[model samples]
Target: MTDSWLPTLLTETSEEGYALAVRLSRTAVKLTQPSAEVRERVRADYAEDFGALIAISHVVATNFHTVAAANGFWRS
Candidate 1:
């Protein structure tokens, strides 16, 4: 298991950047929750929540936006 993460969000492609964004959110959860058991316990809380899912998407989109800007909108 990787104990540490986050060495700049620089990614070579938009797909990779989007993946990183999701990873960033998951990492934040791990850092905050730290307990896998607790996280699992609350999984159902938002498992079928439409608003929660949208919020998650917003967070990922925001991170991807920054990455896209850094990559000059992926223009050639």
Candidate 2:
């Protein structure tokens, strides 16, 4: 099952969420290996970046809103 936040963000046309999803999905696909051992090692490398992505998404969303507001898009 997907997280509740995912649909809400997606429906709101959240570019940050979409960008994060794309990055994570690409990482996941790149890590696919025939050996479970190699897969675990790959996941270990990606786990840290995964955490960073969460933080970065929040920053990106905040910036997005700020830019939108500056353009008077939020006044509507």
TM-score of each: 0.83, 0.34
lDDT of 2: 0.53
lDDT of 1 at 1: 54
For model 1, the local distance difference test gives 0.85
- The TM-score obtained by model 2 is 0.34
Error of 2 at 29 (Å): 26
Residue-by-residue lDDT tens digits, candidate 1, 27-62: 888989999999999999999999999998998888
CA lDDT scores, all candidates in order: 0.85, 0.53
Q: List the residue pairs that clash in candidate 1.
A: none
lDDT of 2 by residue, 1-76 (tens): 8664223322233455445455545444455555777767767675779776786566556655554554455345
Clashing pairs in 2: none
